[model samples]
Target: MPVSFLSAEQRSRYGVFNAVPDIAQLGAFFHLDADDRRRAMAANGARNRLGWSLQLGTARFLNCFLDDPEDVPAAVVDYVAEQLGLQAADLKGYGEKEARWAHQEQIRTGYGYTAFAGEQWFALACWLYKRAWTTNERPIVLFDLATHRLVEAKILLPGVTTLERLIAALRERVAARQHALMATAPSPNQAAVLENLVKVEEGRRVSRLDRLRKSPTDVSSTGLVKALDRHVELRGLGAAGWDLSAVPPGKIAALARFAHAARAQAVDELAGDRKLATLVAFAATMAPQSADEAIEVFDLAVGDLLRTSAFKATKERMRTLKDLDTAAIVLREVWLKIRSVAEIPDGGIRAALDEMDLAAIHAAADVIGDIAREPDEDFQEELLDRYATIRRFLPKLLKHLDFDAGAAETPGQGVRRGHEVLQALDFLKAIERRRTDIDPSEVPADLLSSAWHRRVFPKRGELAGTFNKSAYTVAAVERLRESLRRHEVFVPGLRKWGDPTAGLLKGAEWERARPRICDELNLSPEPGTDVERWAATLDFVPPARRRPVRRRRRPQRLGTPGQRRDRQGPPGAHRPGPPE
Candidate 1:
């Protein structure tokens, strides 16, 4: 499709270039068209006679209890009534759904709300829309304008959070409670409850401001522009009254010079003494759609407000551009926090988060954020060089870590553990299932010959991680050897780097050292008695072999010292008696 024409759903989405449908046309099609193309609104003068009383307002909703705006924007009301089959007055005490219905009714019964009142999308559709950057950072949370309780927007961006990060961080905490029922897990619940309470308290003001911005009637109100404009006009008057000083200028240059002076004056008046702080407060409550424009308006409003403040206040609040060393640091910190978690997905944001890149993230954020901060040429040059260095190095580090972590957590490891734990668990389950009558023959040999018995792993940390600092090493041969040893099987497949007879040992001692040797080789274990030891020792075996000799026995026990000695080494290596 060329995309110039709207699909029924596309029109309703109002998604702009991003594939949202225009709601106006979509509604007409679904309701008026009888869900088909030809049946859609046919300009039937006879059917249009069906009348309605309508109420209309911003797409943003209101508190059911409060009442105001008595003039009630009659065109909006009438339009809403025609679409909704109700009067503008009838839609009071309703919600966002109701308000939208009313707006649509008006669209069907007559020309839409824009033909009479104004377009809801006007401010957002223009240059002012850029301010959404700041507003989107603030969630469109709601608060009781009265009791300061949750009335509409949530007090926090995640007014409800799953706290996956916090819970993951407390791995030790979970481990400590292994012996206790997990249902009794207390720390996560307590932390979540406390965090939510604090967020609600700190975020109420932000939510309220967001609610206000959602209302187009309020944001673009002539009253508001005038309130802001009064400061602009006063500053313009001040600039006209000022001495031009000895700056060279053509007519355009002179105009530019004057405009700066005027704007400066306005900014001094409004922002100098926190005069437009209230608007800033409002800008902070933003919904994603309206926030950017609202914040831009706030900036414009604040700049003008400050420039026109009393001269003394301007001198105090604006602060000279020369003293920005500390200001730069402050701005950087603020930008980092703001950019790191916002949904914008900009480069500056990528740099602030750890998962992206340590060096690159920092460098990218600095370049994106550090426009006017550095005064020292040398320092600026040094920073730029450092940024480049870190950018190159961090991506390398991130890639290496990603590859290493991924290798460690492969599905191979998952299958290895499954054969170990699940085979055991299922075996236990089967034994329990057949406990009443047991027989060795009844148990299939396949059960003992399963992958659980064949696959082995050496100690962790000692192998996969750095060698010197590691606590344990893991290897396939060692793990298999252990599995075999636990079952008292004969060790056979044990090899030194997959070669038979590569190392010194051959028999008993060789068997004992096989797993340790196999740890180095990454080979599977041969199931055998003392298999862990047998397989491990095989790599270390001496070339000499000896035949068994008959001898008298002292009544032997499983724990006797003769049994502890290497049974396959030179016959008399650890003699309890004459060579046997």
Candidate 2:
């Protein structure tokens, strides 16, 4: 694409040798003055001062512009000058290259050197910056190409390296630091891990600085310490836990190793704790190797510990808590634990459930009802078993507490218990239907009918009306009648008409069937004067037909009569009237 095809905004987005009326028209692409013009002519016998301009333009096209004015190496400057055939001294003050550098520097603070201290440093910095920039919301490894050394000098590698090696090293360092950051979140045993990480990192830094000090040339510890600080900050719980991959290799690796060790120790300590020891022992026997494996152990152990603890606590409360309200709350919590936590084979779970007061169990009925309403298909069998178990014990529990089903004082309680009974029956019926081999007689007919009469039927009757006069009442009765006539499993536990415990009256099959209404009454009025007169009126006649009127022929005057006689004689033969 031509440079002119690029818009002003697009031109500004990229570094250019000249952005003006045209790329050729840029002031930076020409000799600045007569002195520079003479120097160009002497060096290359060129009128347009093409040498440096072409080199600079090519470099710019390659996007070598740096933010720092002084970051441009002295070698690059001299090389470009030499390539242009200009002697260093002649090009010194008047060179357009120098002028461009100066202009950029004044505008952008650091526009001089567009590269790092060396090609190796530049490559490493570029790799780190690009990785950090793309992967994170903000890059922690701050560097500007215009500036020669934004980071400490030691952070840069010692020599020019292949892109592959640098990239490999960069990834390894990042991975290690990321591993460390993963452990930065404070935990119950996090203090020990944090101390261990700091100590290990500090020791590594000391060894690195010691090595640098003994080197043949002077080396700065500034870069090493900066990297150290960045890694250590992540160890602090309050730190944002930003990616520390840009940190130097030695420090990041050391931190990662220590963090892993510390995490293992913390897990061990947690496992040994009284609350978690039981679960921890189970996990340890599994022999997990990696951090994820160990963490998984901790998660399972913690969850198990919490559940067991909750079950025990709730059981204790049910045993000791005298207040019915308080006991109900504890029972609810225990029931939730039963639903969510894995079952323990020990009889303690049952013993705990047995400890609940009658009132508490009554409250738990609500939970059971909810489960029945939205049955989990995955655990339908298990749920049915649980419902059956609860149903078996519920009556005895209520009996022991002297529950009064007829009392108005606790009407809500009775209603709640009745609802649970209905749900239990409904669940049993559903399970029995699924298994065709199971006889309908196996269902608890008395319990099902009692639940209907006591709970389900009453509410339905409220909507249907006792009089069975309203549309809702008539519709509900009609539905029942249709079901009975068809011998369908309309009523719970009444699956078949032949079932002995169906609890249906003998004649209901015939009584409930919809009655036929084939008789029609005569609506015609008896013939009378008023009726006949009404029938004779236009209002009673068909609208599409009208009664015709006959016209009377009139006699004409004497002269007209004589002519009329002649006309009448002809009319008797052939006379025509207006078209009907």
Candidate 3:
């Protein structure tokens, strides 16, 4: 097929000679991702040609233009010049043949050339830039035609080198770096990896520099542009614990520009520490306070990481982090509920341990401990009251504390003791229900004598009307309910079975199927189940439907004409065919 923009009439078409105008015009094609600018720029002539046609004008190539004054951005032009070992002046405007001949010469000389360093070998690198910058895809790897073999580039491969050895080596390097970046937030362990990368990359950069130097590279735009990138990558790696302490701020800033991009080990390492804190605080403060604000920040942060090449976060990583964040938030809410009680302040102890900025209601756990130590009983009592306020959160708090793998498992005994609190609540509900349902003369005397009715819930004539005041009234009831809801594993002993349901008359099925039913419903049912609790779940069962009845019909066959004739004993006996 004829090239879209390449007139092909040869006069307008750029070939070998007088290809300068062609190069200049071609330069415009690179600037636009597509005619619509919705696509991306194409880095190379051939690649551009194919993409513009095959992928259509939307196949944008990365604008090799580095931010600078010159026509083809300094970085882009320099990248091109370095690729060919030619001066920018020589590349001012190139003909198809001139560019081709130059490219061939570059090929013969053990190198490939391009005006843009950002897209040295293939159009793909620039394409990747557009994808990430626009759509936020991962850093892609493709063949670099100018170099003749695979390069760290991302777009279309140069048609020149197919050397198996070089491809393997380049693949290994990219693979290893990519593998390292895939790991979750960097720790100190990433330090050595960073140092090792710098060591390996040094020689490669030197070789690149050597070529430009031998070709009499000036303190030109290309050199400056490359310096900028080196600075950025260096800082990014250092941030990942690669420690580019020797690098300058300019590069660090460049890397920062790309920081929101895909997870780069270097960028992540930088972000995981002080950088992360700063960004998080800043983002949180500025983001809208509505429920959607946190969601927006999450989106922005992830988007930034996507456009960058310093690291990569896989789909799985994102999913895991999402769950972690959810858990953290729920735990925080639980803390608040407990801390709200006046007599029992819950979060005081935890607040002290966290040492973080928390809501006013939350006091550090350590602070509570300190208050408990005061010689003043009144003050100590107040502190204990504050601690009691958080009684509701006690179970969740203990569970959270135990999440620390280093800590010994704390059996939720204190928390479990709270379960009867809920049973007492159930006991109350049952008393109320039975009170409304049955008469005083018919009341079961055993029900009044039950242990549960003896304390937390007092038995009033027929139904306990005067509320029982016990230490475990509301607090125990609420805590137990939450524990059951949270599915937290409690002490395995009888204490864990919760306050014995023996106090209540079991429902018909509770005597036999309670265990199996409780397991299915995630309720407590050793011998008796919480009938009231199960009431909530009964409606949750999917409604069943009966199938329609289909009856089988007996079949009847018509007799053959000969059989019919014999049976009728005449042709007149035969029936006429149906009228059309």
Candidate 4:
């Protein structure tokens, strides 16, 4: 049978009041569908219409008492009991079961107060909805099934009752948090938490704005757009507005342009900053058609941000550009020519590359890659000279590049430059080989290998040729060697370049060099004994060869005729042997 009302046995099993579902006693309640509610009312002895009215009234009084026991009067309880057709004598006999019946009736009817006026009831519903909304990040809905209407509910924060007021409060809070964040330079975790809190406040404002945007009955589109534009500016969202699916096509571009102006303001505020330079480079990539405009803005911002005296002071500190003290005027002329070709002089090249500030080089590379395709001989010659100079400086310059402290873009930037550097080197090498009678493969492997290894490896300032500058035990080295040999790979040694430690054999020389390394490290090549040297040792002998031992056969019993004949023959054989 379908469950109409929860019997005592059923309530003991599934009642919310028994355990309330959550250990913390959070929002927990029993819910019933409309059909179930109707059936529950019928099963709760509400067979007649008056019985149902009495049940609902008793439930309302009980719920009111549960919500505020001190506020509900004793007369209201007596009135509810009288409406339920319970006499004073019957009320005196009411116990836990009757109280449970009233609570269950409230669940069935979905009414906390049957006597409240329509407006007061709606207000109470709104208050309940707000309580649930502010408790968590969940969306709350207030719907009236009978009226078939939706109620817009808003949480009333301190001195902020309306949605507009709430948004203003959140916007102020975001500005305060941003100001505090800038003032205090907190730890990364602290800053992240503050940033997240600000985002949360911003999210609430966006949500409210979005709701307002949809309901044009009250707010005009012009006012809404103006408000949204200002919000984007305050948030520093620079050309980025999200959740535009509901926005009209005519409005998107205007909103995006408004947001992008914040990005422009950022350029002015954060001038000469390398991080901002990176952003401008990215903007240039994304908006290639308008790259000139963006680049011009970035250049102007950087120019305005840089102090003039700093340049003069820098030149004075350097004293001279040339390592050989050439004339200052000549050096300046040479520098102007170098700047015309967009090349960094040798002194600044290391600092430039080390910082992974490739914005300047990126422009140069693009120009070179594009222009090098020209068939003009003069242009090709000029390109070759410029590429040769760049290639010569980079190999030395890249060695001192600084990597980021944590898991940052430092590694990625280094790798990107490393690839570009190799391409130029190979291009130069191809030219050199074509000019002379040299083979391309004849390039110095050791020098190239060392440079390439140093470039990609994350750790620096450690001794070369070790697994992050840590020694390996002989057993661990052997296991690693066996694994590598099985896989047919020989990589760098596990020990530091000069550390007295067990080593790994690498490359084509592994077979020839293993025994020597073993000797130097004072380790036995054999598995168990020190006396047994490496297999390739000159005096080492292969283990002795051994023949299998023969087993003696058991004598046969003299039972069968053949056995008996063999026994007699043995007797005759003893006499024949004496004769022999």
Whole-model lDDT values for every prediction? 0.31, 0.35, 0.34, 0.33
Among residues 3 or more apart in sequence or in different chains, the pairs in candidate 4 whose N, CA or C atoms overlap within 3 Å are 238-259, 239-259, 239-260
lDDT of 1 by residue, 81-133 (tens): 45544445554443333333443444434422222112322322231222221
Worst 10 residues of 2 by lDDT: 211-220
Q: Candidate 3: misplaced stretches above 4 Å? A: 1-93, 96-415, 436-580
Tens digits of per-residue lDDT for model 2 on 1-580? 0112334564344333232324243334322355443443443333134443433333333334333322333444444355556544443433334454533333223223333347645666576745643453212122233123322332221222232244445544554444444333334464343334323244365322122112122111222232223322332332222333443434333433333334333433432121122112212211111212222222333333334545664564465444545545667687776654436655365556566565756766554444332221222222222233233322322222111122123445433333333333344435533534433334333333332322222334354322211221212222222333343312222123222334543365534431321112322323374566666794664657666978988854565667877866755587667699
Off by over 4 Å in 2: 1-39, 42-50, 64-115, 118-167, 181-457, 460-580
lDDT of 4: 0.33
| Candidate with more favorable, higher TM-score: 1 or 2 | 2
Please provide TM-scores, in order, for all candidate models, with all chains considered together: 0.12, 0.20, 0.19, 0.19
Q: Which lDDT value does model 3 have at 17?
A: 19
Best of the candidates, TM-score: 2
Ranking by lDDT: 2, 3, 4, 1
lDDT of 3 by residue, 74-137 (tens): 4444444443334555533333223334333332232222332353423544443333232212
Model 4: ten consecutive residues of lowest lDDT: 468-477
**What ranges in model 4 sit over 4 Å off?**
1-105, 108-175, 186-388, 391-445, 449-580
Question: Which portions of model 1 miss their true places by more than 4 Å?
Answer: 1-415, 441-580
Better of 1 and 4 by lDDT: 4
Cα lDDT for residue 13, candidate 4? 30
Candidate 2's TM-score reads 0.20
